[model samples]
Target: MAKEKPGDDKSPIAGTQSLDRALEMLITIAASPQPGMTLAACSAVLQHSKATTHRVLRTLVARDFLSYDDDLQVYSLGVANLRLGSEYLRRIDLRRVALPAMRELVAETRDTAHLATISGSDVIYIEVVDSPEPVRIFSRVGDAVPAFATAVGKAILAWTSADTLDERLPETLVARTANTITSRSLLIDNLALARERGFAVDNMENREGIRGCAAPIFDHNDTVIGAVSIAGPAAKVPEQNDSALGKSVVATAQAISALLGASPDAATALPR
Candidate 1:
């Protein structure tokens, strides 16, 4: 008989396996579309014994990472996690540094400007500077749009690594509008074009009456951290002036990136 291997056996890692399982349970709870998840539900999804799952969950509740309601018999993310997330966003430093530049961009173009970061398969707008024009476009600060269908999202995607893109983007793109790129090949081509031009454009791809242009913001490490965009009605964002608008947005994004300690050479190379 062959010697039994430790890998084949049920031996857990010394100090981290429990942490991993606890984190997975938290993720499962967070991912549920419903308001909360039951202990039995989490156990079923985790394929762990109910007793073990309960013990871990109680521990998480004790530490305030999750909240357990005795009356409802449900688990939800707790205030402690909210505190952690809020602190993480605070540390990003990008949002605080980009606001003035974004305001300037909006003032110059008389079009809405957005600062967004990629979250999973979507672009989450963290800041919005509204245009004063009566007919200008508007976007809420916390809203999300499909990453492949928006200029800001596409600008970041153009600078994303292949491995990260593979993990974040679905194989088949979802169509948001008639002009949205629905094929992987076409999206690849589109990103290539954006990379070459140093900015991205969305011509009624995300919505029928809107047009937008954006450029990626880089960090000190030369990593694409976020993007800045200018958006307006299709009539105002005419095809003839797209290049000029793209150049302006890229310049504004570069200015913001520089404030965040981005490399001077890298920032200057981005169509400024």
Candidate 2:
């Protein structure tokens, strides 16, 4: 007979359904496009009764994971989330390792440089080095962008395992802009190109007037831990120079990977 899992009912310590539900609610709230969510709104979308959802929200608010505006009756992520994010970054050493290369990339390209990692189905920015130029893309450290619509996201996804890709990608990709890829087949083709070229391009797909090129960053074990990108106004990032910029991003990523102790051979052999 097969061995029982640790969390089975017969185990010494059983799983907690309420904890699972609370985490699910937290994820839903975190992913909301809007700044805050009302109790009714969260309950409606989560399919949970008002009383149950409210109880979880109250607990989260008390713990500083969520913030509540009593007057507005709205809730949003709180300072505790920021602390957690900081802790995560510190633990991974990604920010510390990527910042120098990111700054150099910005100086070389005169464009905004970003470092991001996958979180659930989204790409979360952990570090950003703004361009010295007057007009540049303004993105925050904790901002989350759709993985299927950004160059950094595509570069990371191209090297992700097939099973993980299926889990991360949605059935229908969200259309962030007119140029966004809505079909999975087309996305696969794009990934193939990224894999072959060792870089990816957004081409103003995530936002109008913005274009980005990116390459993946690997860890000591050759795992793709994140990506680094160069972003700027579409007019400034022309298709004619995309190849050159792609090479620059790929080289920067490789340098960072080396700092993280990844073998050059292992990094180059990353699977698509």
Candidate 3:
């Protein structure tokens, strides 16, 4: 008779021990510091006999879920894993992934929170979480606003490449309000400041009576994908309180980025 597998009896569902072991092995291999693991190392880490470990590895290799390096005598993730990851990333809905964090931001700041993506020289509001306060900034989803005049746009633009900035920004930046930065040179300087501080501020630049703070969201590749912002009436979101609000916005943006597979270290890294 064949020997019983580990956790066979303890498993909640019957006949799942093999599947569980296979999944655990995959997780262990993926989390390893080294690029790959030898059969012996994998066996030791799994705390299973070499015979049992080899069987599992062979099955995974056959399914193209893992690859064996003949010369290195090691096993690593294979093309199948990449295919699954690609499918997962492709199906991800950015608006849905960012909604919870946006809600939390609105709760924390008592201001309207927005999730926006860049489209040419404009920022499109894809999602919004309204503040609970009686008096708050009102914004609608699908609203497109000038990129240079808003905190969300500045947050994303700060991390974008120089060529992209030049291509997107027009030769003449039309001012939306008295406080809007119309000069390209000055706006570039402001973006540098935003990159340094990890957040951006709109001090009545986008709208006369509104002020906002925002931070950029990154993806798995460490690219700036979007931005999260909290906006409110100037009285509530005062210029003096920008630092405090900025920290909140940055934290929220980082939280959203984490869901999108961006490491905290990568999120905090300086713009290239």
Candidate 4:
């Protein structure tokens, strides 16, 4: 006889039990169309005894993670589940929809560009377009620095709720450079300015000797998706383009917005 594998018989059973116990019944009910499924259906999907499945689902209903409508006696997704899933889907969509626009920005700027979306206290870099310049700045996909510290980050934060802003950064600061804003009050004033101007400039706040300019990207829903930024050496970028660099950066972001079905306001907000 072959040697018995360690816990082989019991391991799979344990895993199945844990999953069955965890599936919220009310949620399952809410997810079903026509308001409910028969007891037989639940057993078929979970491959468990009807009694065990019913027990788990009833518990979920009691906790408000799910609900049972007696008259309809059918299940559908709960509002809470919808809300949670919606936020996730929104960001995923943001990434897909912004790609075309960021590509266009890169084409026009001839410098590196990025599409950034806010994540918690930081602005996450979702995509980047590399600089054609021989000596260039290279930022990979999915790299995020603090939003309070970068041009693109500030552009997105400027439109975010103030309460969310306070939670991410205090009035004091996390200094990344000697030029970093150490004063909370000053940063707050700058945020207000960004709100008024519809754009933000990093001015070497995050990295010394590097300058960055950014403008926010908006969706058809009027929600801010992220920002597009042009960053390079301060000496080279500003001197080479005069004010045209800033103008073009802003224009690129606006063009991205138009692609995403933004309002006509995008025309005026981001200009060449």
The best candidate in terms of TM-score: 3
Judging by TM-score, tell me the better candidate of 1 and 2: 2
What's the CA error at residue 206 for candidate 1, in Å?
0.7
Minimal lDDT window, size 10, model 2: 5-14
Show where candidate 4 strays beyond 4 Å: 1-92, 239-242, 266-272
Could you give me the TM-score of model 4 versus the true structure? 0.60
TM-scores, one per candidate: 0.64, 0.66, 0.88, 0.60
Distance from true position, residue 236, model 1, in Å?
A: 0.4
lDDT string, candidate 1, 1-272, tens digits: 99987669655578888887898999899888656999899999999999999989998999999998888899999898889876764576788889989888988999999999999989999999999999988789899998999999999888888888887686678888889999888898998899888899998999998999999999766788899999999999988889999999999988987876577667335332
lDDT of each: 0.88, 0.88, 0.90, 0.71
- Please, what are the lDDT tens digits per residue for candidate 4 over residues 68-150? 66775544444566676566556656667666766776677667787898887788888887877787677889897888888
Query: Per lDDT, what order, best first?
Result: 3, 2, 1, 4
The number of residue pairs in model 3 that clash at the backbone is 0
Candidate 2 regions exceeding 4 Å error are: 1-92, 270-272
Candidate 2 matches the true fold with a TM-score of 0.66
